[model samples]
Target chain A: MVARITFESVHAGQQLPRLDVPITASLIVAGAIATSDFSLVHHDKAHAQAAGTPDIFMNILTSNGLVQRFVHDWAGPGARIKGLKMRLGAPNFPGDAMQLSGTVTAKEVIGQDRIVEVAVSGKNRLGEHVTATVRLALP
Target chain B: MSGTEKNNWLEKVRAMVGREALPPQTAADPVNLPMIRRWCEAMGESDPKYLDGTAAPPAMLFVWTMGHFRAGPGREGGTLLGLDLVEAAGFTSVVATNVEEEYLRELRCGDVLTQRITLDAISEEKKTGLGVGHFVTYRYEFSDQKGEVVGRTLFRVLKFRPPAKTNETAARVDTDTAGVTQPLHPRPAITRDGAFFWEGLNQRKLLVRKCGSCGRLHHPPGPMCPDCNSLEWTTQQCSGRGRIHSFVVVHQPQIPGFQYPLPVALVDLEEGVRIVANLRDIAPGKVRINMPVEVEFVEVGKDFVIPAFRERQAG
Candidate 1:
């Protein structure tokens, strides 16, 4: 069962539960298409191979979207994402697995809103795939 | 890569910074009600200001200057030139990584916008999971017809060379021919300000919200009235009658659960505002500008239903 989280229930230094995600070719390409990103390497395996990559890889936009999903899933419906500063690392290729985890770094109150900061990371077999600092405002 | 070669390429790229990479280009259509209506429908934004034609949503900072899908305005020359130089330098693949926007002014209908793009920064060569490449950042400045800056955005992208696979054998690429289903109709992004529209649809009643103060009727319902800025409003049942003020046919990027060459219409409702919906029960070619269409609720999924339109003969 999915547990609901609230600002009152959250504290600094709390660890978020890990989420496992399966990377697939369709997910990589669909994310690229949905964002109107037409870079050949994102969808064309042949082009990717010729350019030197072993296969098509995920784009940063897809990674950003995944991070949003991860944070929202844990924060519950009332949480509002204010900002995300993320950096990509290892490539997420098809047939691989990505595990995401995060920790609450800080919580503050400002003008009737509770603001929380989360330091999140996603990793695969190759190592850390993405690292990010996400900020959210909750009532 | 040799040291001298790298230096030469770096110099060429460095020249792009601090210069207007994209020239100011005028918007094809000044901010208008029809386009705003379409944008709100697609984004599921029912903000009353956007519907009543008083002010446009601030989130639409980039929409004012975006050209058509394939044949619209070209990217700024300097930015394009810099990209060409980078591509020539062996970074052949590119993907946008991040966007940060700051809106300064509320754009309204009839406001003509122009944009200028400046190359902000270019990172040094970096090696990681996605081969080697440089990160390029461009700052877009959007201004009004009066040359007043209204908004700005920082867009960053990575251009890299694909890294060669070490041991994995080549695999077949996935394509639509693999019997990929059409995309399901996208769920509306509901918020507190616009929940009533969906509720009205559930009862099969076309509801238009009217301001308690000004009595102005607006579609894409929201809590506040744009005319009077009143928080009080009431819902009125519409005749479900409207005419196609504009239409478009989508053909490519087939999503699952939707027919290709989908016909979407922007109907000017009898209530005096406009709404957008799919034109059903008619072929794409038969849909004409200014044709009369009426509302029809479609059960797209088990718990999801949305209003679609059907053609009607002139009385």
Candidate 2:
């Protein structure tokens, strides 16, 4: 197992590892169902097409999840995300891939603890799918 | 619809704002390991913290009190504050536009969640590429078994009238998908409970879940052993030797990533457990029950591998 990333070990401008996420219909639909999003566009291809997409697209909750996973995967366990601010752009449709990459933008020391901020973005074939600023407290 | 009619309809629909979409609904099951495992699997998430600790993935905040769990089966579910009104107004299709959540507390196993949702707002009909429709938002307040507020999420959706069906418009529906290709294989839904199995596979070993208390081996790794219901368990490596118990050939609705007619089999391993895997190196029609097979680890994509079986060679 990789050592858990620590507050002392991280620095500004450090690029977290990249993750190439496969956007499958199963993933899109499973995330919708898992996140309790039952909206037709997140599952039904016909409705998604009618709603101005080529196929069933991902829900915001699922997109949020994939982003969090990206961070947790890099930061290792025991690191807790304080908050996430996200901006959605292109829809994450199935049969595409989202390349998730992040860079540490800033770090703060608060009363003996370290909080790190990362600027993360997911890009697909069309363009940026989702961009987020995630804050986490490292142990 | 006339201006007077639209005005009256909007007033009636807007008047219902702040009304409860449903009675305060409680989660059918408490926060649990199994559901968490399943979620991690679908996400293809491999973090071990979710499995080792009582804390669930924070991303699952909305799952506990989602529509289906609270409504129970055979119940009206996934209702927006003014969904019926919007649908009645000819905005029959819906798509979520955004979601914002504020987590106030950590969610742990055995926490029963109850939530109340009310219509927050419904915007005036606006023209969009999909068609003229309204943007609706809902406010959800969640509480745990102790009545302490745990989280809040705002869900925004566009309830729009679909564009008139045309050959080109129909063709555009799939425009987002026409040029795409399937990757090596769909990721396996491996959770922490089954992480050991996959990790073992990475080492070229076939491991089965063994109950530490009863000394019984079980396939399809689970948190609890069915025989002794023991929470304690270990793993034992198998020789990858098995026999086909039953098999099926899939030929329809071809999903990208695998060849068809694909042959999938349920094999009884010599270690006294049954496992399911894809069959390789043989024609689909040539497979039969009780045929001998051996496990072979095949890497379909970068860092992605699955245990498949091939026909056992003669002794």
Q: What lDDT is obtained when candidate 2 is compared to the true structure? A: 0.81
- Deviating ranges (above 4 Å) for candidate 2: A1-3, A8-14, A36-53, A105-114, B13-19, B69-78, B166-168, B171-315
TM-score of chain B as predicted in candidate 2: 0.52
Task: Give candidate 1's chain B TM-score.
Answer: 0.50
lDDT tens digits, residues A17-110, model 1?
A: 8888888898888666544446687899887766655578887756766675677667865566666667676678887789999999999887
Model 1 per-residue lDDT tens digits across residues B69-107: 456345322335478878888887776666665556668
For residues A3-114, write the lDDT of model 2, one tens digit per residue.
7799889999999999999898999988887777777878898866655455788888888888888998888886877667776766787878999999999999867558
Q: Can you give the TM-score per candidate against the true fold?
A: 0.50, 0.61
Best by TM-score: 2
Best by lDDT: 2
Which 10 successive residues of model 1 chain A have the least lDDT summed? A30-39
- Measured against the native two-chain assembly using Cα atoms, what DockQ does each of the candidate structures obtain, in the order listed? 0.04, 0.18
Kindly list the per-residue Cα lDDT of model 2 for residues B156-271, writing each as its tens digit: 77888866543233334222255544332445646779999988888888999999999999989999999999999999999999899999999975654678899999999988
